[model samples]
Target: MQSIERAFDLLELMADAGGEVALSELAETSGLPLPTIHRIMRTLVSSGYARQQPSRRYSLGPRLIRLGETASRSLGSWARPYLAELTEATGETSNMAVLDGDQVVYVAQVPSQHSMRMFTEVGRRVDAHATAVGKAVLADLAADSVAQLLERSGMRAQTERTITSVGAMQDELARIREQGYAVDDGEREVGVRCYAVALPGAPAGAAISISGPEGRMTRMSTDTLVPLMQRLAEKLAAELRTASHGA
Candidate 1:
């Protein structure tokens, strides 16, 4: 059990370090003795759970892709009911997304009942700078960390309103933090608007969003949706916590 815990901890540390790190850096960050970390890393590398790069740094391995995909599916399943409830309440499409490296991956969605509706298929990956859910996830990170991530994933403007400058993104994130939510007004796609809030205490960097046509998703609607979104986020977070403990 101890060995398993140590291995998982190292894997999480590697992910937090942008998916790659040297042994010395891991040791410094984990405060684990060099020999223990070395042994664990060797086991991981041998098991195909980690890869030793040419730079002698360790990175998350491809074998974890299957596990990640399975976990994402499970998370999506757990989120469906909440998203359905959100869509029912707001009469707009709702989605759950998680930050994967520098991108946001949509895991689940409940479309609005309206004939004209927004749809972002599950498993679609989008740049973090152009989506409300992405901003909600990024707003929790440090400024330097956010910059490092954006440097790795270039800020390409998806639409005219998409934030393309790092400074502008920083300002946007600051506003998100201040407002306790993020909004994407025709940033990811023209004529669509989205509002999102981060799931507090989620196992990963997760957020939930509501989206619809610009005409319907107005400031007045925002005053109603934001509070409901926040309440649902809190409820989901609490349920996740309970499930983790029960497990």
Candidate 2:
């Protein structure tokens, strides 16, 4: 158990560094002895989970791709039916996204039947402060973490409606938390509007959203969208819980 914990700690340290670290730095950052870190690194490298660079630095290796693929598949499978239901009901693009640091990455999506629908490919990432799904998930995070993420993300505006001020964003997040979902009124794109709800479970960063043009989205009130989004989130949560139990 201790060995596993130590190994995970080392891997986390490397991940926090955006995937690479020097041997000495890894030991220092992980608070493990150099010899111990070296031994574990060797084991990880041998197993293809970590790689040693030409400069003797360490980074995540090819085996981590297998793990990532597994995770993506699990998330996608869990979200597929829910996204489909949402799309069918709303006739809008429905997407499942998760916070990846300061960005929201689309993990799964169900496209709209309309010919002129929003185009968001799976695996595409967008600024947290500028998107509904991003804000919805961010509102669930700690305030300090939110601040740190905003600082890291630079508060860049994707459109005229995008929130560029940290204070304004904080106020907006507070409202989103109170309302139980987030709304982007053409914030990320000129005519796109979105409504999002955060998923509750192991990966707290997960979120589900419905997006369409402002002409359609603006006609609906938050009271209307919130209930639908909450119900969908609950359904997804229930599915994830069942899957976990089965696993």
Query: Against the hidden true structure, what lDDT does model 1 obtain?
Result: 0.91
Per-residue CA lDDT of candidate 1, range 11-63, in tens?
A: 98888777999999999989999999999999999999999999999999989
Tens-digit lDDT track of model 2 for 108-217: 99999898898798888899999999999889878877886788789998888889988899999999988788888998899998999999764447889999988987
Query: What TM-score should be assigned to candidate 1?
Result: 0.90
Misplaced by over 4 Å in model 1 are none
Show pairs that collide, candidate 2: none
Residues forming the 10-long window of minimal summed lDDT in candidate 2 = 11-20
TM-score for each prediction?
A: 0.90, 0.83
How many times do residue backbones clash in model 1?
Answer: 0
